[model samples]
Target: MAKITYVNADGDSTIIDVANGDSVMRGAVLNGVKGIVAQCGGGASCGTCHVYVDPENTKPLADMHRVEDELLYFTACERKENSRLSCQLPVSEELDGLVVHLPEKQL
Candidate 1:
């Protein structure tokens, strides 16, 4: 399992053990971590699962796809260079220390 930390806008954080091969959004939703709406349920259609990856350690994460890159533009919060759609980021051992911050809100 990979240790994935989810930090809300207020700075409150939750650490969840996400199984390898699972998307970050799935880990958050299954464990009841607040903040991610996942409106499209991993379909990458809704921007509700948008998150900012840990800038310090994003090298292990997957490259953004056409769909996710476009969806980030529609997120409730303004997009950042580290912005990513959680559903598109599949967890792996290399991402054990991944930290993702939840936007202020997911509409």
Candidate 2:
């Protein structure tokens, strides 16, 4: 299992042990972490699962796809260079210890 750290909007952090192949959003929601609504479930259609990948670990994620890029534009929270839809990020051994900073709001 990979340990993922989620930093909430209030600067509180929650660490979860995620099984490989699980989406980051799934892990966060399963653990009942606040700040991640994931309103569209794991589908990329909604920007509710938006999260910012820590800059130091941003290079490993797959490049953003067109649909994800478009939905990101509509996110209620500000988007950053490392903004990503949590559902789009699959957990892996390489992603162990991955840290994501949640936006202030999801809607």
Candidate 3:
């Protein structure tokens, strides 16, 4: 399991233990953590599960796929260097202590 931290735009932080092989979005939703909407479930087709990976994260994430990359352009929040789709981030021991910041809104 991996302990992931979800920080809301308002500064609230919630830490959840996500089982390995689950998506980051699923962890947040199941834990009832505010900020992540995940309108289309864990599908990268929707940008509702958007999040900003901690800029200081040292773990190596898999390179972004074309579908997620393209969908991010239409997110409700401004895309940044750390912007990512939580659904595309599968949980693993390597991602322990991962921190992701939620945007102000998801539409």
* Most accurate candidate by lDDT: 3
Model 3: residue 56 alpha-carbon error in angstroms: 0.6
Positional deviation of residue 24's Cα in model 3 after best superposition, in angstroms:
0.6
What lDDT is obtained when candidate 2 is compared to the true structure? 0.91
lDDT of 1 at 84: 93
> Which has the higher lDDT value, candidate number 1 or candidate number 3?
3
TM-score for all models, in order of appearance: 0.96, 0.95, 0.97
| By lDDT: ranked, best first | 3, 1, 2
How do the residues 1-107 of candidate 3 rate in per-residue lDDT, one tens digit apiece?
99999999989899999999999999999999888889889878789999999999987687899999999999999999999999999999999999999999988
Model 1 over residues 1-107: C-alpha lDDT tens digits?
A: 89999999999999999999999999999999999999889999999999998778754778889999998898999999999999999998888989999999889
- The 10-residue segment with the lowest total lDDT in model 2: 55-64
Q: Across residues 5-107, which tens digit of lDDT does each residue of candidate 2 receive?
A: 9999889999999998998999999999998999989889989999999888843676688999999999999878889999999988888889999999998
Off by over 4 Å in 3: none
